[model samples]
Structure formats: structure tokens, C-alpha cells
Target: MTVRAVRRTSLVEQAVTELRRLVEGGEWPVGSRLPGEVELSRLLGVGRSTSREAVRALIAAGQLHSRQGLGTFVASIAPVTDFDRQLRRAELAHIYEVRVALEVEAGRLAALRRTRADISALRDALAAREQARGAAELVDVDLEFHRAVVTAAHNPVLTDLFATFLDAVRDASTEMVADQGPSPEDHKHDAHAALVQAIEDSDPQAAMAATRHNVEHTLAQLRPERP
Candidate 1:
């Protein structure tokens, strides 16, 4: 079989990917100066423009920074890979446990900090979730509603943290939703609705309960034989 030809984008993407791997793997630790563009092009075996673009992408990702007189330098070490890899490998139960701990607090904070705009976004996300007719659509909308709740907390770190592993959450949700098979097109979810209501009412404990209630229902279905 013949291998597909690589495009210019694939070239730059791999270059950036390799750069991130080097940085995250500690080969190129934080504050260390990166090799010059000429050297980087040589190392990555690509054109100078390709390496330049790769560096620009990493700079945008907050992994690297450039100085006027000096070359590029590692800005910060994103410890995203190792932990995220483990998280991806984790079982559904373990992932759900993490989700509950994280989201319960998010819901509590959201209840306290939600603005009117936040509420509108939550309603829209929940509505989309309710209206989802396909499993893929449901998986996306489910996470979208949860993301709206996390956003309502008004915590940048919380929102960034959730966004970091959102794909993992989506993968788990896809499997779980697909496992349960098809849901009725007209059926609506009450647990998430309860969550939205609790947040709307500014009731922190109720929000936490609603968040836990929603997760527990899914976890319960997964462990059907539990007493």
C-alpha cells in the first residue's frame, strides 16, 4: 500500500508537535533558550518558514516566548501530557470520580457567581442538549452544558482545567451514551434541568446535589448490580 503524501500543514504540525514533546518531556525545560530558526529547520528537516511557523504556534500556546535581541525561550512547562495521558488511560469509574469532585465544586461556585448572561448561556446549552437527536450530538451538547456551568463559576483556572481534558470527557461520554443505545427523540433529561434550576435559584447546596444527582444516575446505570 502507498502512503499518503504529506501536506505543508502536516509538516508544520509535526514540527510543533515535536517541539511540544521536547518541552513537555523535559528535554527542553522552562527558561531554556531554543535553538535558532536555522538550527531548528535543520533539526526538524524542514524549511525555515515551516520551523518559524511552528515556533509561532508554540508561542501562541504559551509554551514559548521570543525576545527582541535573543532567540526563542521556553516560557513554561505545561505538565499536560503525562497526567493527561494517565487520565486518558483511566477507567470510566475513575474519570467519573474526578468529574464529580471537580464539577460539584464548580456547580456550587456557579450558583454563587452566575450572571444573567451566564444563565442565558446555560439555558441555551441545556436546550441544545435536550434537543440533540443523535448520540454524537448528545455527547457534545452534554459537555457543552457542563462547560457552561463551569464557565458560570467565573474561574479562569477551572474553565481552563475543564477545557484541557474536554476531549477525554467527550470520549468517555460518547462511549457511555452509545452503550446505553438510542434514547427517545422527544425524551428530556431532568437531572441536568434540576441542576440548571438550582443554579438559577442561587442555591449552592442544591446545585451540588443536582450535579451529584446527575452523575450518580449515569454511574448507577453503569453499575446495575450494585445494592
Candidate 2:
């Protein structure tokens, strides 16, 4: 297991924060250059080195950029919103509910009618996931597997509904995988293999059970633990 590092704040951080506010507050307008080093130092009442460090900090923070001779300018006036702030608990709750409803039906249909080509696609997806280089690649291939399941069901509405939540679903999966850390993520593949076998045998009840089990287990993993 890896231990996360404890970080110590530095004066450069304060400089970065102050400079960010100055630019974001429109004291330095978008596309407008800041005063030269000497002038900025006089205005901010800081030494040349301190002002330079502050400027560099702002650049790294995405607030400003410096040209060799043209000097530092505000890059943009875009307002940044944290995704964490916008994400609602209820929305996440509903995502799982929707998954359970859609996937159970998809699993049933996949068992009844999955073609040889459909089985091949699912196998390819699992293979790609097994060979995934990083969390991003794993998430991509994992999504492909789920999408293949939906597609194999031969229901256009189910496929379209799954596509609608694809982005958020990807984000949620990425977050969980990152928190859980690394593959072979402990029997997850086994669960998928069971579902595949059910589908191959054309056993609707068994396929539905396997799909529901996987989704419910994912929901449990997503819940916060009590202290």
C-alpha cells in the first residue's frame, strides 16, 4: 500500500493566491499586460525577486502568462467552477438507480439474443481492459464493455439512455477506480465472466442476477464508510 504525503504550505503559495485574486478581480484585465518588474515592485511594495516569484506563481496557476519582451498578461476571464461543488448527492444516487433499472433489462435481452459478433466485442473490451496501461485506459475499456452489453441487447432506447449518462458515469467510475487502486481489482472480472456465461447460455434469469449483483456491488463500493 502507498502512503499519501503530507504537504507544507509556503510563502510562494500566498504570493500565488494574492496574484490570482488581482488578476481574477480584473485589476489586471484579460489580454492586458502588467507593469514592468520595477513598476510592479513599486506598486505591490515588494522586492524584484518576490514580485517575479509571484508572477511565476500566477502563470502556473493559469492566471497569467509572460512573453519574453511583451511582459505578463492576463490569459482569460473565464470563471472556474469546481465539479465537486456542482455534483449533487441526489444526482449520484439517481445514477445508480437508473443503472440498476436499465442494466437488468439489458442483461435479460443480452441473454436472449446476443449474437456471435456481440460476444466478440465484449471479449475484445475485456482484453483491452486487461492490457490497460493506466486508470484512464482502464476506464475507457471498461465503458466499452458496458456499452457492448447494452448494444448486444438490441434495444436502441437503452443504448441511447446509456449514452446520455456516459460522461458522468465515466467520471464516477474513474473516481471509484482511483480510490480502490489497481487491477486485477479483485474478482470484478470474475463477475463479468459469470454474466458472459449466462448470456452465452441464453439464460435470462441468470444473466439478470449477475448484472444486478455487479451493479449493486458497485453501489456499495461507492457509499461512504462509517467511522
Question: Tens digits of per-residue lDDT for model 2 on 122-206?
Answer: 7887677667665556666777877888999998988988887776675555445544554354336778777888888899999
Clashing pairs in 2: none
Residue 29 lDDT (model 2)? 92
Identify the leading candidate in terms of TM-score.
2
- Estimated TM-score for each candidate: 0.57, 0.59
lDDT string for model 1 (96-154, tens) is: 77788889999999999999999999999988988876555666678889999999999
What are the lDDT scores of the predictions, listed in order?
A: 0.77, 0.71
The clash numbers for all candidates, in the given order, read 0, 0
The C-alpha RMSD in Å for every predicted model, in order, reads 10.8, 12.8
TM-score of 2: 0.59
